[model samples]
Target: MSLSPSTFETIVPSRYITFTFPNHHHHHHHHLRVAVLDSPSAATAAASTAAIWVPPGRESDWIFSTFSGHLQLLLTQPLSRLILIGNSPSSPQPISYNSSLHPSSPTPLQRNLAPLLSALTPKSAFLDDGEIPEVPLLVFEDEVVKSSIVEICEGPCVGEMLIENVELENDGVKEFRRRLRFKRMPNFVQSQMRICPKNVTSFENLDNMKFELDRGVLVQPYLNPMVAGISVISRFLEGRTFRPKALCLGVGGGALLGFLRVQLNFEVVGVEEDEVVLEVAKRYFGLEDDELIHLFAEDGIEYVQNLAKNLSEECRFDAIMVDLDSSDVSVGACAPPTEFVRKSVLLAVRAILHEEGVVVTNTIPSSKLLYERLICEFREVFEELYEIDAGNGENFVLIATKSKVRNALEANEGAFLNKLKSVVSGSYIDSIRKIPRTADPAF
Candidate 1:
């Protein structure tokens, strides 16, 4: 069962999980049992299996169950009351509740569950139990894990460092900020990045930037699915040049630009309206200006219109990506804003693309009506449209092409994945494979 991202903030049916434990306040000995319900159907059927008892020694076995796998993630949630099913065949009562539930006082269940909760608490094998300090670690890919708050933009965009083994002195921290580069990262830090635990210097023999890009590493997890355009375009690029051309609408942190340029060897042109974001990208995100990389500080919609008018077919981009967000999200248009999704603007964007080129947009619609409206607008310009739900129930990545070749992409799926594997590590592709993917909505 899937848990909603905002499960704790609101109490909606099938959104929250229920935990059950046998009443232990009495002296009667009984088998320990754990029940977890993640959906409405499961909650309705929980009573039948609520009293299923396990042997005394088998309690540890339940920790490996499907529900246990998500328990660690639960620790980060603002949980409400947990239903405690007593041994008596009566309705359960809330033994304890979170602050959000306006809890009254502790109950007997807290005493019984204390040991089980302690066992479930995550513990580091290398670090001691004593108070560990949070140190500013190095930057991996684009994120500055658990480090001091470094403001990248005036908006909510920022970076912080993750805790690691080595503690840096003030001079070291200053030096890191000066270079804005570090090659070594601890095992735990690597784990936090969801990468294999290894000395980052292992790739010292090769270009470090290429190494990360080849592995398909992106700063934001949602962007991974957004770049599925690479695979879409690969199937039809039989006679095209090995290095494709890409147009990036938003260059926040320059992660997508760097990924496109280094991974696919694309000649990338990045456009960002905010000059401060460009400077921050250069200063903090290691965005370097080179012959293959072009940076423009202008409005994305106007740039697309100008390019459509002046750019030659030979200079057209193979892929156009939109990842910008509106400053005022109260209107519910977050990514690409309302202007970028306009039919006229989208047609202009399509005019400056290769015949086989694809347009991928990152959209975060505030309401169902807005999302449907966005899709209808997209359907007006492109003949074939594919969508990938960012898996967070919030962000969505839409891939649109002028031609009808969805079947071709499916037939070449094996080849496409193989081609990607040749460029990136197999494990990296496997990790991104978990991203929820959906076909066209039949618009």
Candidate 2:
């Protein structure tokens, strides 16, 4: 038999409840359940309330069933009421009635499910156990107009009723179909994933590719080319002049190190995982004929471990710059585990940095938690910390020094900005001067 869309609705006394729906699409009445919570609370209470939604099925049921069970388990007490709406025989009304009567009363379920619910639905206001619950009316519609439940307020049948039902030709299905059509186009493919180095080369030879200083590469405070580019150069200069050796981890395209070599004339040993990127840089990024630029095709972490084991005090680098992937964006839009930031990569950074040397890294500015953890870790090892903005929604650089340095920018701010202005050929230096000296707490 062909499965047809059907809508079912009901009402229960408890503030929390779940309704299951049969999945006829797969020749089975898959139990789909939705749980409604009046408030938010801890896990224990939410779990007790969610237990009611589990039907006589194993853990590997339909998608909806599994989600409902997980949601049930996550809801704790002190949460508000829960309303489970689904196509099952036991599904409840999509909307709850008389929820505003206990304005000050707290529903444990609502509190616990607030974050997930907020992501799925519109914002809501609820009263604390001692506060007021902000309840609003909502409409419901589904495929196949079979049944509905309306919550009635005061005055018998004359009060406001919450309506939940399905339509024979569901509007949702039409929208989905429309979206799928757009997804079939070629341009849409580019939006899904970033262009890789090979594709970039295929589109245009690396030598032919022109680097422009567009808004994508420039932003406020970092507009001063000298400040943005030279600070890096000056840091290296300080290390090279004083200690005379440096190492870089995850050097992509060698643009950063190349800039340092050309502008500041500093020799840098760079390790890159992708030989293609290194080759492209050498060919196109003015890296050719620069003996100061040394390229290594090795994993950055492994390189650090080897350096630690093989390098003596005299052979150790005076400074190290790391620009590894902190998230999918840096790693070509691939989501990495949190451990990548917390342990593996961080340990590698520490292993390579000299005893009294400096280590600089590029990381997203919005990741306050990660930034805090990094700062905490550095505090245990380094004597000073500094950060600089690179602008244009790009990453910020964190500089940790083992020795006392007045400031990373030092006296090179003006000269560096002037140099960058010469290279990018823009008046961005004026805007860069306005950036507050204080580092953003979020970074």
lDDT (CA) for every model shown? 0.50, 0.40
Over the stretch 1-443, how does candidate 2's per-residue lDDT look in tens digits? 43222211221223343444344443564545454543333322221222132222111222123332223332322333444433343332222112112232322433344333332221223224534323222222123222122121221211212212111234443100000001111111110101112223332122232232111121122223322433433444442434245676755435556555555445688886656545544533334435677788777767777776775665466567665553222112111224435555555555655655666655543346656666666566556666555554444556666556554444444543345545543532232221122443333
For model 1, residues 1-443, the per-residue Cα lDDT tens digits are 64443333222333434444445564664433333322223222221211122222212221112242223222222222122222321212111111222222434553355444322222321146564322111111222211222321242232221222111234334111211111111111111122222345442121121211112465354667667645666667544546678898987667778777777677899998767667766755567789888999888889999988887876588789888776541232256588788888999988998888888888777566777778778888887776766666667777888766545345344553466556543232332221112332421
Error of 1 at 399 (Å): 0.7
- Candidate 2 Cα outliers beyond 4 Å, as residue runs: 1-245, 283-290, 326-356, 407-440
Scored by TM-score, the top model is 1
Off by over 4 Å in 1: 1-147, 151-216, 413-417, 421-443
Backbone clash count for every predicted candidate, in the order shown: 7, 48
What TM-score does each of the candidates earn? Answer: 0.52, 0.42
CA error at residue 333 for candidate 1, angstroms = 7.2
